[model samples]
Target: MGLDFDWTDEERAYRARIRDFLRRELPPEWGDIARHGPGSKEQTDFSRTFCPKLAEAGLLVPHWPAEWGGADRPTWEHFILGEEMWASGEPRGAQYMNVNWIGPTLMRYGSDEQKQRYIPPMAKGQAIWCQGFSEPNAGSDLAALRTRAVRDGDDYVINGTKIWTSYAGLAETCFLLARTGGADTGKAGIAIFLVPMDTPGVEVRAIPSLIGHGDIHECFFTDVRVPASSRLGAEGEAWSIIRYSLANERVGIPRYELSARVLEEMVEDLKQQGRFDDPAIQIRAGEAAAACEAARLLTYRVVDQKARGGAPGPEANVARFAVVTADNSVTDFGLDFLPDFFSGLNRPGYLAHHERAIVAGIAAGAAEIQLNLIAHRFLDLPKVAS
Candidate 1:
């Protein structure tokens, strides 16, 4: 089949509608609030109100099945929604995870009880969830995770610590992973749990960082007890489920859309300061724009595959790396030419973008991992023997 680059008229209209909604709904102070990033308390609090309104307007989960409160809209429409929200500093906040992957993952693997109890709140935009996946020792290598969940009667006792958990300080629930099989089981030993944040022995401590307030955190689960019913899927099934979820997550952010917007803003700033005439700066800005577009097209390929009901493959890895490159390129251009803006609150957007760019390589998954996947899976390169 031939690759079609054009968006349908309906898709264009959907994109326009999202932009219109954002323009009409966002408060004047939104830029200031957004400067702290999506996981900040301000943005998280704002989303509680904002996202419900989005749901009321039928915008929160358009790609979801009608049974789940969405319109059963095409995937491209959902991708457009993501691009618009991300470009607008992600007013949906942490709930974007629900719209992007978590809710869908639950629908696929969650028990009927889990779906009825949890998904309704999410569909109504009244839920906040944190991903308890990474540990200090297992950031990208999830198979190496040490968090243990021992089965006890009808319950499981969980004891482990998660690091760099975003939105944990405010999330009402956690999508946690734990080791159920013996230490030797590797990926086959893992299990997923949907634990309520209010459960006993759950502790969350905020970690100060440049990304945003309340963004990254350390969560401790000591003797935390949850019913077996809370487990997302069958024991030893987490690796497969996680692969599906990460494919959705890896390309969901539309970070290049945000990067492109920030690049335009940087160019405007340079123009105002009479620096656009500099040939070297102009060339760098052009390179950043090209990077953003390259990332955008690569991401669209993955989205198109999803639209066709095909599982994303290593192309998602390539797209993810392209996005990181775009993010860093735009931020690097801003810092190199507009250093003054990043020093203080004057250019909150630039400051916010810079902070996110700093962690772009690390968040979602490490960029190095993406490169390895691209080398082995995408390029079909021979692996180096250890």
Candidate 2:
């Protein structure tokens, strides 16, 4: 028989509960939007109403410990929840920091109070957190960031600008990394702080993305002050914590349900155009179908390993690489159906696979970075001219 990673009867029941909640609590319009969901910047903003409701339903942070307001379910349960939500084409309502990134990273490395103060509100959706990691000068080379923070009595004053801050304009706090030691401290001087969004001298400006969403912003901090007690873990250890969290962030294995919805729509469009029998288009569509299924399996494999307490290692990158390709391929196939009769020339359909493909390469990690990681870390390739 084929490999069976079927959920237990109890797990199945739990999923049904989540499904019922989604049906009752989520906006009715969300069902269709959940599939073929917004990839645009404007659309990426999780519906504000749904986020707090998700928190109320105990669905936002299932992977967290009970002390942190999570349901404390096993990892497989978390996967099931993700599957059900994605399968519904539910807009991913919770920001990653509250659900995955900073909270867990904090639980792993934060002082007890830091965890106590930050995690619960995040899980409850009473607070929204933005990541302050990337900068114009320090994206792929993140350690080169020039943001500075200095000690003054018990308070740390921060001054820096962070770009590509997803949803910062709407966030209530930021998991900010700043040069606590000095500009020359390299990665060693970095410290992670949970800074309130309303802190004086902090500024947020929406930045335009290809998808034209307010979801991405540029967050600026000028002399922002916070007590040192707000720091996550100890001074100078932020490098490891951030790295560990990001590894899991990238490991947020993609599900094909969303792409499958895209495929279904494309097929309908093709049928309407009376070109459903086109051999080349049929072949392309078939390839996308196979790729999407394969990507889903790769993602589930990672979940299986983690459910049993295994680490998400290098193999997890396979999911990121493959699924992105699958999404792009599916998009390419669908966009080809754009009718030429409107202006006597064909134009791209906004919802077509092609539109998604162009942006697929940018999400999570760029393809080049993923390949480099696989090469050096997985393949054990020797570094050049170090």
Candidate 3:
């Protein structure tokens, strides 16, 4: 737990190079692209173009194995890239999932054929993936999902619906989960599937919402049949794979980096308007910045553990909850002091941040779930029997 704040020269150099690349390559309209939101069709489509340039520059998926088009960089470098992207309003868009956990999950659990088919596109930065983990009835309690995948000789017929699916409207593939086990199987019987979004019986309907345009959707799979080869691992192996994926995915995005950057912008805006001289505003700004720093350190601990080859643990949950707090704090500060920004008066970034912050606690497996994990795992508290 000793804090080492100094970055190695190599790490510093790498980070500088990445920053330079972003400054040079990010389009002039990047702010507007980002304002459209990460899951919006504009950003997703933009990613299809932007990400390949990143891959060509050897910046995309640098942590992946060399065989999968990466330079085999360290886990810290991978997280550094994520922090930069998130802070930059995620110009990489939905492809971040491909780099973060989806590709890694496939690398760990996919069959050789599956890896060959899927990992290359992801590595090339030409893939957009949507996660089908939540449904209206089974979001937080994912094991309670009713998505069924029945074996029919060489294929499995999938029938179910997934709600709150981001980037579903334009994604090329879905990192899907469905039940392959019986009624009594529970988590053990669940399995992962790589389903093509263009497959017959797959329907995506955009849900009208405040978060962003085409950001969330209702995805219905009606008797969709895919080859059994689409399954990621063996049947009954999904829970473990999912646990692994979630562990990687949870800390993958450095949302606190974005929150911290937004706070800085808000503070600058207030200062320019002569409002930062107020004691109340300054105190709240310090509190929000401190929250962001606390979240950053907690998240760095998780990344440090990963860099040392340590497995994910309750620390990630703690970091995630801290990030949610940071997100809300920054959002609230804007709403409290810079109220006119919400009305599209002058700052569009504030509105974008507000829209995204609203879902920070709910998305990526709710903040409450993380608190429960902290209680049971970190605090070693016993769970009450239902």
C-alpha lDDT (0 to 100) for residue 255 of candidate 1? 88
Candidate 2 versus truth, CA RMSD in Å, comes to: 3.9
In the range 302-374, model 1's lDDT, one tens digit per residue, is: 9888888899999999999999999999998988899999975678888889888877899788999999889
Write the number of the candidate with greater lDDT, choosing between 2 and 3.
3
Give each prediction's root-mean-square deviation over alpha carbons.
0.9, 3.9, 1.2
Model 1 stretches with alpha carbons more than 4 Å out = none
- Candidate 3 lDDT tens digits, 196-239: 99999999999998888888999999999999999999999999
lDDT of 2 by residue, 1-386 (tens): 24466768999898898889877876655533432324333334544556677777778777788877886789877777766765554455435445656778878887888877777777766666678888878875667888888899999999989987766776777888888786787999888888889999999998765433455678889999899898887789988887777667665535466677667777777788898898888898899899888878887777777777777777667777777877876766655654342221342233433434554566556777778888887788887885
- The clash count for each model shown is 0, 7, 0
Model 1 scores a TM of 0.98
Worst window of 10 by summed lDDT in candidate 2: 341-350
The CA root-mean-square deviation of candidate 3, after full C-alpha superposition on the true structure, stands at 1.2
TM-score of each: 0.98, 0.86, 0.98
Return the lDDT, model 1, position 225. 98
Index of the highest-lDDT prediction: 1
Report, for every candidate in turn, its global Cα lDDT versus the true structure: 0.93, 0.71, 0.91
